[model samples]
Target: MAEKYCVENLAVSVLDNLRYQHDWTELQILTHSPVDDLPLPRPLISGLPPRRLYLHPDDQIEMLKSHPNPEGSIPETPVTEWVLPVHLAEKWTLKAFASVFDSMPPENSASPHRVKRVLLATVHDDSTVVYYFMHDGIVKPRQN
Candidate 1:
């Protein structure tokens, strides 16, 4: 039997996996009308993770110096992260990744020109998925 081939299907699969495994919330799929002339390879989705994924080292140093309450630290606000869903059978290259960033629909952008960083989530045969964080451009290196 052949595997199912639907953009929405693949996106949804990853979304469900994210919610279940990672405790991601407020997931939404960004759908765009096909331009015919200009087309993206896959649909992009965004969601909020339970904790911060990217934190600046300088901020952390400041926080440590200030000495925050550790027992019940309340997060100021949660930010949504982007997701690029791909099937387990699919293969991606730099060109493929560039294409996603190059022509991402405005719906994915937080502002007019701001392109959000994405999490590349790949769904497997057993409905398990692996994720990798994908940043838009060069950024300051974070501590390990």
Candidate 2:
């Protein structure tokens, strides 16, 4: 069966709630195409945040390594995640999700080429996890 709606529209559909419920001033439509290069047909979106939303974990480690503190206790930085608002009723599939992922720039701006943020969306119920892959300058995964 053909999907009724695309990912970009689904994202905006949720954004409508962000506008009305949170009363966030200055909501802006960012992009509608996939953040990178996949096939979903909704607009990808972003707003110039009231404040920066998330921080990547690897970036935190790098920062801690760089800090000149004598103790070097490894200051905690929040695992980077985008703070996007989403609803429970709406349905999404992989194709739709790929669109969103394709739109984002892999590396973030904080460390020039060391930082990156991936979208971490939650349903209104706050139970299910929908993860997307994001990269900044190719990182080696830690061995368990």
Clashes of each: 0, 13
lDDT tens per residue, model 1, 56-80 = 4555556555767754553545567
The positional error of residue 114 in candidate 1, measured at the CA in angstroms, is: 3.0
lDDT of 2 by residue, 1-144 (tens): 354445455566545644565444455544432234543244444444344344345655666668899365544433333334334466666665555455554445444342244444444443343434444335566322
> What's the TM-score of each model vs. the native?
0.68, 0.44
Pick out the ten consecutive residues of candidate 1 with the lowest summed lDDT. Answer: 32-41
lDDT of 1: 0.71
Off by over 4 Å in 1: 1-4, 33-40, 56-76, 105-113
